[model samples]
Target: MYEVVLVDDDVIVTQFLKRYIPWEEHGFKVVASFQDSHSALEYLLENTYDVLVTDIGMPKLNGIELIEQLKKSKSNSYHIILSCHDEFRYAQQAFKLEVFDYILKETMEETNIIALLGRLKEKLDQEQFTRNQHLKVTKFLERNNMTLKSKFIEKLMKEQNITKDGWWKEQEELLKLNFSDKYFTPILCFIDRYQEAINHYENETSLQFSINNLLEEIFTAKDQQDVQIFFTQGKFLILLPMKYNTREKTKHQIEAILKELHETIYAGFEVSITSVIGELNVKEQSLLESMRILLKNKEQRFYYKYNSIQNFYPISYTRDSIFQDYVEISQTIKELILKDKKDQILECISQQLKQIREKKYSPDSIKDWAIKLIIDIKLSLHALNHFERQSVVITIADQVIQYVETFEHLEYVLADICEKFLEQIRSTNLTTRNEDILKAQKFVQTHIGAKISLKDVAAHLHLNSSYFSRMYKKETGEGFVEYVTKTKMTKAIELLEHSTKSIEQIAFELGFENKSYFSKTFKKYFGMTPGDYKYKTKEKMN
Candidate 1:
């Protein structure tokens, strides 16, 4: 029920109203009655009353003055004024203070007061319902607009040409987007460790909404005229208008803006972002090309650490040699799988990844290679009668492709697949007695990028270190340390021979502390330093 407060300087008037009015029946309760306006103002300050009734002419703190004070405090109380005279000044002041109604005390009766209160209650109810409906409609439109905008951006990114310019214009107008400028610069902001953000929020939509709101606030502060579109995979595209005279100057300005954006996001959400700025392109036709280049540049993010800002450069396609490398790696992995050498298969995959990284292959190329390798492995297993049909394998392969984001995640997935494949092979009467040793070997190979110790591997296998070490040497004809060192050195050699990575980078990639130690270890193993080996390999290739 709506609350009502009655205030009048005369005690008789307040008492008569309180005793005679059927407030509850009219959907209101006279919560408080006061003899003076001072006490009523104090009560109003402490509480909220929806309807206020008071005498217009009082000694101090009159109805006008009380409402003026309440208005200063931003009160939303509907007010009714009672006066003994039909004074124009009093009615004008009451209307100015937005009083609900003015009643002359000489003609006011119980029926007239009750009718006024009933009409006020109906007005209040109608206003509240209208407000709630308006809020829901606003929220729905916001969600629908975002979805439509994202779709339009996705289409613009994919299609080479926008065939219906008028439709595009209509869409922009409908969405209230300002993209009429001739030149636009596309920027891709990628949230680093996106999966961690997803896990933190436990909802992808919530995370994306938060990021979008933050971006909008930052852009609005900077007075940037841009359109932000979000991808489902934690990437945001911002198409900013080209406003500066020179491209370099525009780039610098965008970098400054992005730096502020990065700092704000990190400070607020504790999430780091990497932004790649693409070259400027014309609005309608060249937009798709610029988007392609922007996405291609986004792949270079793997080359740098997180929380970086980089500019896009056109990528020169030289895929013949890369395709050849992929073929060779595919054949090697197939052979390793056929032999049921899980450790070697993982090592081969790791080396192939290193090669791809060193060659600066695009992210799509790397993903393609990974998908093809999984497909080849699945087909090989089917051919060997390990699986009766391809449906299950195909489903698993699709899941792996969908879920694998980082190289570490892919490594684990592929290792699990190899383990399952090995189990299937063993089901065909080919079982090894030294399964524990094999487990240790696989662990060491898969974790070759990390600093793995004998204790770590032994604990992984749930075996004693001393016994596992002896068993490993007996089975592999090499001690635990020797095998790990051999595996790392073999990978190092492959990198030095086939990749363009520097010796220092190779050393770090192989978990060596320094290049000097890596060089000494390489000389001891290959009878030459890594530099000499790399030079010799290059010379032989030439």
Candidate 2:
């Protein structure tokens, strides 16, 4: 927009332009006009305007002197002179000064002013476009935050409390986002296998476009109406209203849609989406309190971690001492996950909740605390994959949480969680025992060229043959003879399928005493000789 500053030391003229002119319609801003040239020059030094309407004669500083001073200062003022007299000296001097097309103050015409402003409008338009482009570039750079990428990760970890499950509660209480009970549900969506998803787009600009396109596809999906998506940082925030009767049903529907879009439409990660509904009966005072919780709650994130659709009645989960119990349980469970104390994590959760109940804490409190415990573990699992990926004991502990509803449910996980943690913490030869088994497996694997026997292996490890055999069986669930024979035959199959090694050569390489014995073991394991197994596998592949 073009802005004009008039200098006449005439209040009447300034007032006339301010009130009568349709400056806004003409794409102009008449910010302020000076009553004297001294003040006008000072204002010019401090501010900028597209045009200046100055009379040739004024008070302490006349128009001609001001114009001379303005030009002497090398100012970029597109001056428009307003003179009462049409004098030769003034016109000659103004022409030399490059004063843009002078005007007469004796009778100021609307046509001249309007035409001048129209020309100024073109310049302003170009300036605005350039400014907008600059702003967009700035935003893009800020979003990338080259050096601060780690900062983003740190903040997000802190926000979600990679340790605590109630980080959402803190966020909800802190952000003060009141939705006016608008039928809104918060969505927690993230890229699945993020590292591999954008492998094709190695360039920064290209990768950004790919990520952005994926986001666009989410909104355009068939069932994505009534969904408002935002990204607080890297993680997507989805707001989809509950469209089904029960929370469970709605969760299933949301998961299905997110899964189909991610799995079918894209070859990469699903860009997982989750939805948590607001408490329908929460007091308005608690509106802000529940805002972040309802949005980022375990209910929403659970779908991402569990890969299951679960309806969490966050509204129903809130109770008296239960709230406090949930908070404490969540804290303790988080402490376990970080310390890598897998077993006690479960025992700690169950025992703490039990104590709350014994202390006359409401059953509702136990339930809420239990829910918090589940949520805590879920968030940690997001960091540390499944417990089976970690261990069977952890897997069992997790299994109990899902099915925990009665005393039997509580008992199901107790022994496993408590026993494992106790065993791990109390033991000192943990690494040595693990290393021994691993060393045995490695020795057997690498020594296939020689006639390696259990007695030979025991002698190498400086252990008695009987105890060594038993330890091997206990560790691998197979007797030494059986395990060695199985390993040799398995390696024989690989060689048969992918190598040109003859039967005799393969038997010798696998430490088999003879080809006939190798063939026997191979047949027992594969129900076929090495030759027949290779042929069948090749046929199946074809």
**lDDT per residue as tens, model 1, 1-542:** 99999989988889889999898998999889887888888999889889889987888788889889888885577989888969798899989988899999897789999999889999989988998999879767766776787787777767666765787878878878765555777788888777878899888777776777787777777676465565646788877776646777887878887898899999989988888887665575566577767764555555545788878766553464455554347546755765678889878877777776677766566666667667756654553322433233444665565555455556666677767766665555312535665556556555556787899888887788888888777766678888788877866865675566789988887888999988999899989989988888879978
Clashing pairs in 1: none
lDDT (CA) per prediction: 0.74, 0.57
lDDT of 2 at 433: 51
Give TM per candidate: 0.52, 0.31
The number of clashing residue pairs in each candidate reads 0, 3
After aligning candidate 1 to the native by TM-score, how far in Å is the CA of 314 from where it should be? Answer: 4.9
- Cα distance off (Å), candidate 1, residue 345: 17
Local distance difference test, candidate 1: 0.74
RMSD of 2: 22.9
Error at 480, model 1, angstroms: 21
Where does candidate 2 stray beyond 4 Å?
A: 1-430, 538-542
